[model samples]
Target: MSHDKKCVVIKIGSHHTIAGFNNTELPQCILPSSYIKKGNDYIFGTINMLEECIDKYENESQQTLEIFTTVDENGIPYNWTVIEQQLKYIYETELKCNSKDFPLIITVPHLKNELANKVVERYFNLAFNKLNVPVFQIVIEPLAIALAMGKTSALVIDLGSSGCNVTPIVDGTIVKTSVMRSRFSGDFLDYIISERLNDLLKSDTFQMTDTDGDIILSNNDSTTRSLQTKDSIDIWYESNTWIQDFKINMLQVSDKELPELERYYKEQAEIQIRQQEQLQQYSTNNTEAKLDAAAIASITNNNPLSQKKNFLFKGNKNSKQTVSLELRECYQLSESLFNPALISDKYTKEDGLGEIIGKAIKKAGASVSSVGTNTVGSLGASMTIQPATNQSKNNNPFGSSIGGNASNNSTGGLNGGINSLGSSTTTPEHIYSTLLTNIIVTGATSLINGMEQRIIKELSIRFPQYKITTFANQITMDRKIQGWTSSVSMCNLPSWELAKWYTKTDYEKESNKDETKEN
Candidate 1:
């Protein structure tokens, strides 16, 4: 099942994706600023941006990149729709041009680091990319973090300011046999804290004020231009907190539309009912005179003042309008958070990450797991970019960026820092899945984690004795891995410059020394 095509993984981060930062007049969204609240519902806004981004790629190289976006929805955060928006945008934009190569995998968000290598490099390349030009798909931020922290069997944690979740990995293959769950990510922690504080600060009038002496009411950051009446807050907090509105403008166009919708729907229903009655009435028997009279022949009077006949509109357009028809079948996953009769945080708190499995070594479960994995993740992580030691992840790009020359032979990100003894392809080419937690934060009602185990089991059955790690960061066993670990390093050995930090001769020697001491 191998084809010869390359796949690309382009991920936009929270800081870049979420907007309204300079602390404009808009009230800041306690969470990621990607949506605007329309009185009750959260309107998705990021779809426009993603559509624009995909257009850039397609226009440049005719490459209809397949995007597998993951979403994490814990504690009623409203960003899953943003991921949905991106998917919809991709589909509509590509479909308009009649594209078939544009496929997308939308699943729940994932956070473990070890799974990075296996999911993206190994499974993605071997399965998805091989079916097409499948250049390597790049791992985005959190996965990149797991790849950077050098360790074989360790827990990876990322508490980014926007969101937070932890991933556990063992060796290269994720310990599917263990217990797994998704808690309130760091993003949740931030907003909950903020909201709880606001709830406590009401006065006799029950109006809460900002840091300044102004009354506050909501969470959305939409207002753009500056006006009076809003008290002038501090200058420093302006960028982070002072946005009063995030919307482009405050026009209640929907109200005007509601009346028209109702009128149209009622009008259509009445027309249909009248037409049915007419058919039933005519079904019996009608003389030619009766039928012709019903058809409304022209009426005339001889010289009784100037008479003119006005014909009713006989257009083929439907006279009736549907006001609020069911757009999509919405299942009650849970009630909206902002609604009255707030649901308890206990059962509804489920972030919808993988939570169900057969409770076997083959099932790394989540709270919302089912059959096929809606949320898939790569496992092999840990990069050893030794250059730019002072700067943490400021690694060299493979070549220059897209605008720059593509003649760069040196690698970037987890590239370089490879002095391996394995005969593998690409830099740091032996990555493995240390966990099976593909934590897609997107809102898919059906998801599972055993798919990772299933992939592993099948691969094991096929290869028999060749330990199956991913293709990103290469893995090595001092001796051959008879389908098991001999001695594995997440990143290959360190380069000569980084070796100065190592008092020992090499990584292999260091690994062997640790093993010998354990014995």
Candidate 2:
């Protein structure tokens, strides 16, 4: 690999795509993996960008536009062309660079053998032929996570918008049979919040007097309006937009944290009420208020505990809408992740996220015991030159492929085989213990404020002995890039060239050999 040429890493998730040159701490382009084609003009990028474009076009009726996206319920790319376009947009438009100038390193999930093979084959063709690139490498998303966390092995729980993937990695390889998935994810939480917000809007407690409503509606600050809106309210077209914003800003706490914040709000409201009462007391004596009915009514109106609570929303038009939420209702929505019965009556014990984690861990432990520690993670092995198979069927360019035997490299990839230490381990119990100790939690779903803590608390009740590692701040909002960081770091190593694919000279030689064979 030449130092002069550009080296690029792309981390594509169900929600977003992150891309940048290697060695940078942060990615240059973080775009949503969504595209909408309206005639020849296409719309793609972050959700915010898409919203802006939608508003610009003012296309309230969405029936005419064709939407292209790769995300499925399980977070796998269903259409390779959509993914290819996303990458193409990043390379050609955002980065303003030719694909052939950069060696591409991309990430894929550990799933069905047939699916991964298809994805990899498409990538090779896209890079080598369409983009005219030099070399392409594929990294398993979970193994890249372990590398990013500076761990040889860990149980990675990726809670994404599409779904949750609980995978166990041992010495940098994913344990295929131990992997588990669930449909419940961040999108589910958003739906619950939206429902709860609508329910609150309809509650009698949310209504306010005309006078109180006037005071709240006149307030400039969103916080003051939120504090005062126990009165009247308005509903608008941006209900979903504001509900999402409120959840991101306010609903990041667990059930435990909610009570404390609620108490604080009550105390502050009481203090203000008491001050007003004191001012009124100075003006009139208690004995006089007994005879003066207006004074008595004023005192009755001063009770803070009975005051109206407010949730204020400002929409795209600067139009104001207000609703009130009971603190219990706010936190109860988040609990649906743990107790699916809260979301719907049909949910059983097996539907909970904790139950899914427990089952995945148990499966991983059993596989480790069965493999007997010597080859615990054979499925997640490092990249290697696979025996050249006939490419006419799939058009797979890299006879070299991933999911080979594990490599001993500390950084996790472009190595020979499973870690020598992993192969030499003697005790099955030790392997299980090691795998259970470091539970590396990553993905966009884990970004919710108290999400990591709640998962840890729930798992602790079930498995007290095993540790839970959330890698809290180690991952950014664009959690997919954590894996790209690891891959970038690993590829920068001097010895990475040992796993290099067909160089320009090598590609030429292979092309001639194939031509001769065809003749």
Candidate 3:
């Protein structure tokens, strides 16, 4: 008997992707061209690489392969092509169906050679032909993260190299996939950095070659010493740039001068405003307000669940479900996304980007609160019993005009000794009806752990007699810069202990087999 129940989640990353790679210590990727000009150049190269990966799949075709990319409403990438053969490695995933012990979510990358007739579509044929037990669920990455966070609702803002994506997750699921595609990320930040670096150097000419993504700095002056990220490139780019700007603007400026700068900025802004006013005639604006009398209308706008009308039901009966339903959008956040910032936030309170992310989640319209202890559980059992009157009657004789004690079991009666007993039958309405409270919160650190705490506290209150508990988790991520990294499991979670909320297992009936009926 296999005690090991295998559950997995795979998160593939761009950094892990291998396309036109040269892994021979010379360079990680040796593209045909040093500097890319046309977008097709990258695509064509990527396609060729995908073609090469088919050989690997041919060898281990037994594994279930599910190829999926984040989709727009229309199913296009960058509004162009969905990324399939991207990541060269693997990650984690959670399951779609409910499980008390939810499966560990994992990521699977479609290799460069894995692409056959398509780009990143996972080779599904393996599950049908090769693997005996294979299951698959495809979803957008950011959408998956929002789902995993266990939110009541939110608008997810995932800033990455692929793009700066904004998605609204209403209830526990997604309303639309197409409108959430973002085309800006840390890569865009890098581009901005490079552009700013050019402005700093006072040159219109410079070449940025990502030799295995090693940020190298070589000046025409020849003294910058080819600054590879291994030494200080990432430190300078990700961390130092912000510090440098803050220092340059604030260091020497006096408190008295600060007011002057503010005044000057205001005057400049006023002038700019006049110039913008002159241009407003040509500009277009149609803004939507948060509290417009149309919040419900807005909330229901992108709901995909509503589109799922009963294909079988013939009549136009109204539904009792007033809340918005969700379609599963399974995906993962890339671990390599802003590696340093995420790491830094996990360490300190100030400038905590992690908390900013958490706050963003709340701002997207979610209910958040700490859990307290309360408990209630209900069960009903029924059996038949003979009926009896609560009142006593006096006996009567002789005249027989009236009889207070007209006993049915008198000698004249045949089968009057028995009477029908009222049964204590239960109906569906008698169930311990309670709402599964959905709470969404985000902060500097331990957002998930905080959620767990809230969950434990709430469960304790909601079901006091039952024991709540949790299994230990050991998670890890990429390297860090400063501060001692307390073993890297649960990055968003702080120094939190394990806890669980167990249900009352001792029901009137007992069975190892869980038998649930479909309504």
Candidate 4:
């Protein structure tokens, strides 16, 4: 990189954006990708600002702030203007750097080549024209992640807030044909939890409360759902937040273990109830019969099991309530991730997370197949082939051709492509064992205690012949710094300055040439 220009690397994702100067090993700023737009002003840089904006708007129902740069179902950014503003805020305000003095290296996810290309073009226009930045470089997110993990080839799985991105990288390049994505991610789990909680609140099993900590009854003598008030809405929001935290704290096990864990909690809840009743009876007998302090002291001071069994929620007005979450309910909540059909009204398991991973693995194998063993510069990847299912010619599940023209076939269906590679050496089994063996799982959702293990277990069962090694950095710093780390590493190389960064003058000249041609 040019010594004259300060350089920065940024990793932009649907949930958060990480940015910092190239000289630093760690990111200088990490901000949530959220903003509230007012008439002529925009508030961003922290979740607090968004919360403040929300509170302000809630108070004045007539003036609602517009949310921007929110992630869509496929983990892609929805707004360009907000994204630019976020970058501008980070560059000028957070980092205290002038755009003109620095070049930018950004990481982006490939939501298929065309959409990815458009997003890249949009960023280029924003950096070159709007921000007047001196230079810019784009790195695909999977490639950056792979490089950060110190692997030239691996399966990169990003379970972000909005969706899951399964990308296979070989020799530090994204295997575009093998990449797969789905909207089923952390947010879906949150949604299901909230939905289940709402149902629980409406049922006779739980009671609603008002601001003054008073019980609020359902309209038809507790037979109907309780009326939703501002306090209820506040409680629901806080409950969801708590549930999200709970998921990270708990919910780690194989699907079979979920039921057992639930039953354990239920038994603990019963034990707690029995303990409470016994304590009450002992207190009543001692007080009524005028027993001494020594008799009261004989009872234990603490019960850890009782504490663990308790579940509580509060209304916005500080009204408190408690109920033990049924073991079955807890099991069902986590189970929804592996089997979406459980929550879906139509009961379709076609889009489950495991299925998505299997399909992605298949695509990775196909990509390796395309670059045959005999080809020069090939990674010498191997696989164990299985027979493919018959499918319509138009709907090839594995987007890329297994043994045919790789360039033309790049997208595939979710279910049909898992076994399409015929008898190739680069089968799912081989790919999972060799080049793609180092599974690097990243993103906020991966913080859930057992998520990494769950993936390893599931994939291990799917491809028994392969060794399914997985790596997940639980630290937030490591998760967000992958793009920046890769960028810094690239900049340190002698050829990077000459090879990658595109300057403003070059961009303007190209734009002018295009305009002139159009005229």
Error of 3 at 369 (Å): 24
Q: What TM-score, computed on C-alpha atoms, does each candidate reach?
A: 0.27, 0.71, 0.28, 0.71
- Which residue ranges in model 4 land beyond 4 Å of their true spot? 3-5, 47-62, 204-243, 253-323, 373-429, 480-499, 508-519
Give the deviation of candidate 2 from the true structure as CA RMSD: 9.8
- Per-residue lDDT over 220-291 for candidate 3, one digit per residue giving the tens place of the 0 to 100 score: 634222222122222322322342332222112111222343455456645655555445534544232223
User: Residue by residue across 1-519, what tens digits does model 1's lDDT show?
Assistant: 122111112233342222111112221121222433333443333444344333543364333322222332321223443444543443344323211242221111242333332233232332232323212222223223333343323223322323333333332223322333334332333233223223322211233234453644222322211111122111111112311110001101111123343455556655655565566567854422232333322211121112222211110111111111121101011111111122244535233222211122133322112211222222222233332121122211211110111111123322233233332221111122223222211111111112223333434553344454422112211011100110011111233232112211222343465457559
Model 3 worst lDDT window (10 residues)? 478-487
* Model 4: ten consecutive residues of lowest lDDT: 376-385
Estimate the Cα RMSD of every predicted model relative to the unseen true structure.
25.4, 9.8, 26.4, 10.6
Error of 4 at 299 (Å): 26
Stretches > 4 Å off in candidate 3 = 1-4, 13-133, 202-519
- lDDT of candidate 4 over 262-357, digit per residue (tens): 566567655655566567669786533432454433332232222332356543333456646644555466667777787876655657667788
Q: How many clashing residue pairs appear in each of the predictions shown?
A: 70, 6, 54, 9
Q: Highest lDDT: which candidate?
A: 2
Q: Candidate 2 on 405-478: residue-level lDDT in tens?
A: 22233221232344443455435456556666777777766766688777777677767876656565444554
